[model samples]
Structures are given as structure tokens and as C-alpha cells.
Target: MNRKRCLILGASGGIGEAVVHRVIEDGYAAAVQYFTNEDKIRTIQQGIPEDQWAGSFQADLSTKEGLQAFFRVLPPEWDAVVFAGGHMYSGLFQDMKEEDMDALYYVHVKSLWMTARHVLPYMIQQKQGNIAVVSSIFGTEGASMEVAYSSVKGAQNTFVKGLAQELAPSHIRVNAVAPGLIQTKMNGHLTLEDLQALENDIPMGRAGTPEEVADAVGFLLSRSSRYVTGQILHVNGGWC
Candidate 1:
């Protein structure tokens, strides 16, 4: 298998970390992206050999400057791009402030668009590339308290589907992985009882691990799934 260079956005997050490792294990070099988590990024650098590490770039996906700064540091081309950086805010939609809503949109939706804008031209030139976004089960089956988060995730899913078709002619495949209930820092707000209640809703009686979702992303990025495009592969274990 040919080793491709992959740039993983949000490499400091829970799912991002796993995807980074999985991509590396698949024989690809990684360019890890981060916001403020320098420690984690450093850890990743330490684990991967210097030759296989394309280096990490810091950028706040929620800010225009951050986006531009990251793009400025990014290489002109990559073989694979994975968007795994996003945050979820739980609250009644009516109670959500304009700032919170805007943050969600910029972080989840805008960042993806902007990052792709910078990278797609490079991919187009190559005529072959892969893209993956980490979506949520809530994107399809909306959540009550997480209305804003759900909204943006929904947009991400649609973005993957639409962009996949538009880029397919160039042999640039795009897909998404929608994870149900993953044990990550994103769920740290939940109380034990709340967590138990949420777990009860899953048919599997448990939540998914980051590695499991990473496994799905790894498959989608591989030649084995080259025929697949514009699909939302659910890693929810029959939850939704």
C-alpha cells in the first residue's frame, strides 16, 4: 500500500487522537492539527517517528484569524483530510445566546468549509484524495437540549454528502462517520445518572469508544471503500 499524507484537524480532541493513530498505523504520515492543546500535540509528536510525522499546526477553528493561520502553515497538498475538531453545547435552543450559536456554526460548519476551500484545490490538482468528517448520531436524530450542536452537525453531514458527489468526478472521495454515544470529554458534562440513562437508550447498553469510530474512518479512507462516497456510515451500534 502506498503511504499517503493525512492532515487531521482537531487532533487534540478525543476522537481525533484515535483517528490520528489509526491513520498512522495504516502506514500514512500524519499532520496533526490543534487549537490550544500543545501538550497533546507534543505527545503525538513524541509517539510518531519524526520521519512519519508531517508536524502539527495550531489553529482555533472558531476564529477567522485562527483558520487563516492554520492554512498559512499547511502544505499545499495532502492525500487525506479528516475533520475531527468540533464542540457540542447543550442547552434549550431558546436559551442559547447568539455567541454560543455562532461558535457552534463556525466551529462545526464554517471551519469545515474554510479548511476544504484551502485544501480542495490541492486535492483537485492531484485528482485523487480522501476526506472524512466526524459527524454525530444526533445530526440525524435531533437532540432536545443540544439543538444548536445538532443543527451544525446536521449541516456537517449534509456537507459531506453534497461535497462527495461534487468531487467524485475527480476521484476525490468524501464520507462521514456518525458516532452515537462516545465516551469523550464532550460528554463530561453529564452526571453519572444522566450517563446511565443515556446508556440505557442504546440497544447495545453501552457507548462507543473513540477507537471504534476511528476504525470506521480508517476503512472509509482506505482503497477497500474507494467505491463508497457521500454516505454516512453510522458507528452507533444500532442506537439510532
Candidate 2:
């Protein structure tokens, strides 16, 4: 008997790492993908037992060829896919250059589209699989000074919704998790005051944890959410 397998992109990030642990704990094999974090990737691999079907691959998500190459290295069959790779660029819309927009589009929108194009065929052929993409609250309601980042994420949010409807007949469910103000390396640039100000804005009065978002991913990928698809689960501690 072979174990079910999952492919996690951006496995070195805070939420991605938590999702990896959740999937493994749920008794599924995982193929972790990371870029520019060899040490962290190695540590994560060591934590998994050798007998489990686990492996790591490195790929830049800014190009189609890179995404294709990443998928080429994975197992032929995967029961689920969690796309957690994205980049954030903040600046006033007028100050944002074309290059900045291009970079965000590539990482947040194009790469995810390419990865799904590459992997969806397998899931469609099997007529059963789960696909989850990590989005952000900024996607839902545009963020100030982060116009490009918000736009790209908004596109992703729309993509998952439309894709879900199209893939439903084939039994391939597509959904997204939109996180708000999660404490991660991504937020390292923020000052202490900035953090507190953002926390105050949330109705729940604090930022969410990667583990909390990961648990949402876990639910969407499990039997519990078997009938749930084409939805955006917001894990934003009441932050709109």
C-alpha cells in the first residue's frame, strides 16, 4: 500500500513549514519545495523519518521554466498541492516602477498559474485531488502603499475561485486561504510600532499565527472539506 502524497511550494516559509508538519501528521507524504533556503530545507527534511515519502526540491518561482522543472522532479502522483510561494513589494503606487510590478506579478500570479497548469493535468486525470493557494487580506481589500502586491494577490484570489468551478466536475477542488498580518520573516521589515498599529486595526486585536493558517489549509485538504471548494477562507483574526 502506498501512502498519499502532497506537494508544498515555499516550504521554508513560516506558514508553509507549519503546513508541512500538518500534512505529515495527517499521514500523507510530502514533497517540499524551497528556493534560496538550503539550510532550512535540509533541517526540515531531517525532521521527517527516512521511511516516509518525503523529498525537497529548489526552484525559483519567477519563471515558467523553473516551475515546470520543479514539477518535473516531483512524484507522478500527488493527492494535494499547497501553493505558498509569493513575494511582497511595498511602495506608493506612483513610486512603483514597472520592474516592481513585474516582479510581483511573476512571483504571485504567473508562477502560481504555471504551477497549476503543470500539475492540474495529473489531478484532473485522477479525478480526485485538493489544490489550495495562500492569498492575503490585502488581495480582498487593496492595501495602501502595496498596490502591486495587492493587485497580484487579488488576481490569485479570483483565479482560485474560477478554477474551482471549472475543476469541480473532474473532482479536483480548488480553494484559497487568505491570511492577514501573520508574524513571519516576510514581516521582518516592519518596526515595533508598525506591528502594534496593524494589530490594533484587527477586530480581534492581534496578528494571526502560521499554525492557525496551516490548520485552515489542513482542513481544506482533508475529508472534512470534501464538499468545500471555490471558496476563500480568511484566517485574519477579524481583520476584515
Candidate 3:
């Protein structure tokens, strides 16, 4: 039998990379999506066994054209779609530029909706599918200095809930993994003092590892979560 096909967006990021490993281990033939990180894409490809590596796609998901171009090359029969593509912006709300907010909206919200819409027909035809987004803990309980990021992530959370309900009847599961504080490049800017202060607040007293979050994503995308849908699973180390 052919292996289940899984499309992993933003597969070059820390969490995305871990997710790739998890999906392969869970028996899915995986394809990856990246933006401009060809070097990282090559690195990710090297890690996966050739037989299980589906393909790699590059697209700027912050624009409709990019998404269209991406799907043009992406096959239509994916069993799962994991949206792990996005960036974080931190600064005072007042200091934010309109363009930055637009990019966030496009990347974190618009592209996801469009990607789902594009895949909906195929999933409905097959009558089974999985959609999981990598969201953030700040999305659940708002965070300061991350107003735009939080807003878009909150939108992502709501999108998952609404889309899950709509797709559940069709046997298409939609959910999100809301990770608390993963040690990824997104937080590479944090100083030692900043890191310590943040870690002190978490009940676990440490940041989550990308693999931990990937474990959650893998579950939601597998038969293990057959009865689950429209849920935001938090991997926050009991911080919230």
C-alpha cells in the first residue's frame, strides 16, 4: 500500500523540522514547504530517508500569488496538512508598521485559510484528512509587545475551532498545537537575562523543546486522534 502523504508547511523552522521527523516516524511520506531557506531545505532533505521524502516546495505564503504557485506544484492527494509556517514580531503596538501587520495577517491567517480551502475538495472527496496549525500560547492568553502576532495567532485559534466544526462532518479533522516557549530561532534574540526571567514563570521552569510540540502535532495528525477535532492542544509546560 502507498504510504500516507503529509504536506508540512514551514518545514525548515525548528518546530517544523521536528514535526518532519515525527511524521516520518508515524509512517507518513512527507513533503516540505519553505520560503527562502533553500539551505535549510537541503539540510532537512538530508535528514529524511530518500524513500520517505515526498518533495520540497518554496513559496512566500504572505501573498496569494505565492500560495497559488505553491499549490500548482503540490500534489492534490495529501492525507494531512500541517501548517507550521509563520514568524513572530515583538515591539510596542504603537511602533508597528501597517505593512508588518499585513504580512502577519497574510502569513498567519490568510494563507492558512486559503490552503485549507484549496485542500478541502480533495479531503472531502476522500472523506478523511487532517489539518493542524502551529499556534502559540500567547494566542490563548494575550502577551504584551506581541500585539500583532497575538492577534493573528488568536485568529488562527478561532479559525481552527470554526473550521474543525465545519469539516468534522466530512471526517476532516482540524486542530492546532499552541506551544508555550520553544527554544527556536524566533527567540534567538532573547538575552540570557531575558531567557532566565521567562523560564522562571513557567511551572516547568524551562522552555519546551520543538520535539515535544511536534509530538503533539503528530498525534493530532494520526489515527490516535480519530475522535478529536476543533481543539487547541497546549504544550506550554503548565505555564498557563
User: 16-46, model 3: which lDDT tens digit per residue?
Assistant: 9999999999888999999988999898888
For candidate 3, report its TM-score.
Answer: 0.97
* Cα lDDT tens digits for candidate 1, 1-240: 356899999999999999999998999989988888999999888889766898888888887777778778788688999999988888888999998888888899998998888888989999999999999999999999999898898999999999999999999999999999999999999999999998999999999999999999999999999899999999997897
lDDT of each: 0.91, 0.88, 0.92
The candidate that wins on lDDT is 3
- For model 3, the superposed segments whose C-alpha errors exceed 4 Å read none
Write model 2 residue lDDT over 57-116, tens digit each, in one string.
888877667767876776556779898877898778999887778778878888788778
Which segments of candidate 2 are over 4 A away from where they belong? 71-76
Prediction 2 TM-score vs. true: 0.95
Q: List the residue pairs that clash in candidate 1.
A: none
Range of the 10 consecutive residues with the lowest summed lDDT in candidate 1: 63-72
Q: What lDDT score goes with residue 213 in model 3?
A: 96
